[model samples]
Target: MTEKALTIITQREDLPQLFGKRIENQAAIEEIITKIETESRSITFDIETKEGQATCRSLAAKIASAKSTLDKAGKARKDEYTVTADLIQVDRNLVKQRLQLLQDEVRQPLTELEQREKQRQAQHETKLAALGYLDVQDHDRIGSKFIKERIAFLENTVIDDSWEEYKSQALETKDNALRILRPEFERVKQREYEQAELARLRAEQVQREQQEREERIAQEATAKANADAERQAQQIAQESERKEREAKEREARLIAEKESAELRAKQQVIDAAKRERDAIEAERLEVERLEANRQANKKHRDAIFIQAKDDLMANGIDEETAKQVIKLIHVSKVSNVTIKF
Candidate 1:
C-alpha cells in the first residue's frame, strides 16, 4: 500500500494534541515521510529503480524543510525565554550531565569551601576568646598553629635607628622578638646598675672626704702640741744655761740639756708617726678614687656595647652578627694606663 494510505502508529501522546495548527499546516511533511517509507517496501520497478530512490530522498528533504518552518513558527522560535524553557525540556539529559559536572568542578567545591570557612571561623572564635591575655604577636603565633593556613602577614615598615624600628622588626617575625628584647633587657639593667653603682661611689667619696678632714684636724692639733712642748723644753734649757754660775751648776745644766735633747728626739718620732698615718690615709683615698674611676669607665664601655648590639638586633641583624659588632666595638675602646715613680 502507498505510505500516505498507511496509518501511523506511536506509543507517545497523540500528535494532534501536541502540535495544534502547526501539525495541520505541516501535515504534508508526515504524509511524505509515510509515503517514502511505504513505497520503499514495494519493488514496483524490478531492481529497485534509482529514479524512485532519488525522488523519495528529494521528498524527504522537502518534508524536513517544511517541518523545520512549521516548528519555528509554532514553538521552536518563540521568545528567547520561552524557547530556552522548551530547549531545556529537549536537552534535559545533556543539561543535567553538564550541571552534574559543574556541581563536581565548581558548585560542589564552592559549597565545601563555604563549609570549611564556617568551621574555621568557629575554631578561630574559640581561640580568640581564649586569647584575651596574648598580644598581637602571640595571638598570631597561636593562629599559625591552629589555623589550617599559616598566618605570617605583616605590613612593611620603614626601619631606622629608633626603638620603633626594632619593635617593628620584632613584630614582623614574632618568634625572633626575643633577639630584640634580650638586648633591650640588658640595656635597661645595665643603666640601672650603673646608676646604683654611681650612687654608691658618691656616698663612699663623701665618707672618705669626711674621714680625711677629721684626720687633718687631728694631725694639726698633734703638730701644734709637739711644737709647744719642744719650745718649752728649749726655753727651760736656755734658763738652765743662764743659771749656771758654778761648775756643779754647769754640770746640772748639761744634764738638763741632755734631757731636753731626748724630749726633742721623742717629739720628732711622734711627728714622723703622724706623717706616716697621713700618708697611709692619702694612699687609701687615692686607691679608692682609682677604683671608682675604673668602675665608671667599665660601665660606660658596657653601655656602649649594649646600645650598639641592641641597635643591630632591632634592625633585624642576628645574634651572631650583633655579637661580632659588639666585640669590634668593645675592642676599639683602648684603656690608657699611666705609671709614675
Candidate 2:
C-alpha cells in the first residue's frame, strides 16, 4: 500500500477492517509503551549485539509474512480471491496492524524520551562549556565511545551453549532486568508522591499555627480589656468614697459650729440672769437703810416738842401766851411731823 493509503487505513474508525480482533488491545499497547520507556532508560542499545539483531530479525520476518500474504491474495483466481481474501486479509492485517500499533504507541513516548535526552544533553553541554571541554563538532565522540564499549563487552562475553540455553539465558536476563528496574522506578515515583503529601501536611500545620497565634492574640486583648474595665470601676468607687468622706466632714463641721453657737447663747442668758439678781439685791439694801434713817429722825422731833411745852408753862407769862403755847404743843401732837432729819 502507498504511504497515504496506509495512513488512512490506520486512522480508519472501522476496527475489524484494519485489525483482526474486534476489541483492539489499546490498554495493552499503552502498557507496552510504558515498559519500553523503562527498558530504554536502563538497557543500552547495541545494533551488533545478538539480542538487538534478533529483535530486528523478528520485525523483518513479520513484514515479509505480511507481504507474502498480500501477494498470494492478489495473484489468486477471481473466485478464489473473493473467498480467501477475507482469511488472508485477517492474517496480513494482524501483522501490519501490530507493527503500526507499536509504531503509533512508541511515537509519543519516543518524542518525550528525545526531549528528556535533549535536556540532559543541553545540561551536559552547559557544564562542559563552563569547563572549556566541549566542542560542537565532536558531539558524536561520546556516542562512538559508548558503542565501542558495548561492542567490546559483547566480544569478551563468552556464550558456550545450545540455541535453547542461549534463548533461556536471554529471557532470564530480560526478566531479571525488568524485575530490578521496575521496583527501582516504582520507589522513585513513591518517593515523589510521599514528598507531595509531606508538603501538604506542612502547609496545614502552618495554617494551624497561624490560627493558634490569632486566638492567643484575641485572648490577650480580651484580658487587657477586662483589666482596663476593672481599673475604671475601681477609680469610680474611689471617687464615690472620696465624695462620701467629704460630705461627712462637712456635716460634722456644721454640727460642731451649731453646738458652739448654742453654747454661746446659753452663756449669754446665764450672765443676764446674774446681772438681774445683783440689781435686785442692791435695791433691797438701799430700801433697808432709808427706813432706819426715817425712824431715827421721827424720835428726835417728838423729844424737842415735849421740852418746849414744859419750858413755856414754868415761865410767868400771860394766860393767853401760855394758852397759845399749849395749843401749839397739842397741834403738834395731832398733826403728822414734817421732820427733815
Candidate 3:
C-alpha cells in the first residue's frame, strides 16, 4: 500500500475572499507552506558535532519564521471580517435597544398595575402567615398567659372585605390557630403547675436536709464531749497505775539486791570449805596408793625367790647354794642374767 505524503496543499478551488475583499496573498501563502513542508523533510542534524548543532538551530529558525509569516497572513485576512462582524453586531444591538425602549413605553401602565398586584398578594401572604404563627414548635417558649392572649386575639379578629379574595382562608387559618393554641394553653398551665410543685418539693427537701444536718452536728458534738471525758479518765487511771507500778518495782528491786548480796557471801564461804576438804582427801589417797604399791612389790619378790630355790633342789643342787645364787641374780651381780617374776 502507498503511504500518503505529509505535505501542505490547497484542496479547495473556490475563490479566496474575506469580508467581500480579495485575499491577494492566498496563493503566495500556500506556496510558502509547501516550500517549508518540503524543507522539513530534508531537515537533519547530529547534536554530537558543532556544524550539525548549528544546522538544527538554523532549521528551527526557518520553521519558526515560516509559522510567523503564515500567522501574520491569516490575521491580516481575518481582521477585515472581524471588523465587519463587529459593525453588524453594533447595528443589531442598537436596533434591539430602541425596540425594547418602545415596547417598555407601551407596557408601562399595565406593568405598574401588575407590580402593585404582586405587592398586594405578597402583603396578603405575609399577613396570612402571621395569623398561623401558632404552629407547634419543637421547643415552645410560649407561656399559658401568652397562649391565652394569642387565642383571644385570633377569636376576636374579623376576616372581612379587607382580606379581598383571601377572606375565607384568613378566617380558617385563625380558627385553626385558635384551636391549636387553646389546647397548648392548657398544656402550658399544667407544665407551669408541675414546675411550681417541683420547686415546692425541692424547698421542703432542702429544709429537711438542713434540720437533719444540724441534728447530726449536735450528736457529733455530744459524742466528742463524752469521748473527751472518757479519754481524760483513762489518761488519769493510766498515769496513776504507772506511778504505783514504778514504786512497787523500785521496792522489789532494792529487796532483791539486798538478798542477792547475802546469798553471794554464803556461796563464797561454802566454796572455800569445799575446796579445803577436797585437798585433804586427795593427799590421803596418794599416801595409800604408795604403801600398797610397796607391799605388792615385796610379795612378788619373795615368791620369785622361793620358786628359784625349789627349782635348784629338783636339779640336785642344795637349797643353801640356790639361795645364794638367787640372791646374787636379784642384786644383778650375775653377768648377763635376770630373774623375771
Q: What TM-score does each of the candidates earn? A: 0.28, 0.22, 0.36
Candidate 2: misplaced stretches above 4 Å? 1-177, 242-341
lDDT of 2 at 192: 61
Tell me the deviation in Å of residue 277 in model 1.
2.1
Query: Number of clashes in every candidate structure?
Result: 0, 0, 0
| Candidate 3 off by > 4 Å | 1-99, 135-142, 145-149, 152-158, 216-341
| CA-lDDT, candidates in order | 0.48, 0.47, 0.60
TM-score of decoy 2: 0.22
Among the numbered candidates, top lDDT falls to 3
Q: Give the per-residue lDDT digits (tens) of candidate 2, residues 238-313.
A: 6657798865665565456545655554555455545554665576578779978886765576455445545666
Q: Please identify which of the two predictions, 2 or 3, would achieve the higher lDDT against the true structure.
A: 3
Candidate 3 lDDT over 149-202, as tens digits, reads 777777777889999999999988888887777777888889899999998997
Residue 126, model 2, lDDT? 50
* Alpha carbon lDDT at 119, candidate 2: 78
Cα RMSD of predicted structure 1: 24.6
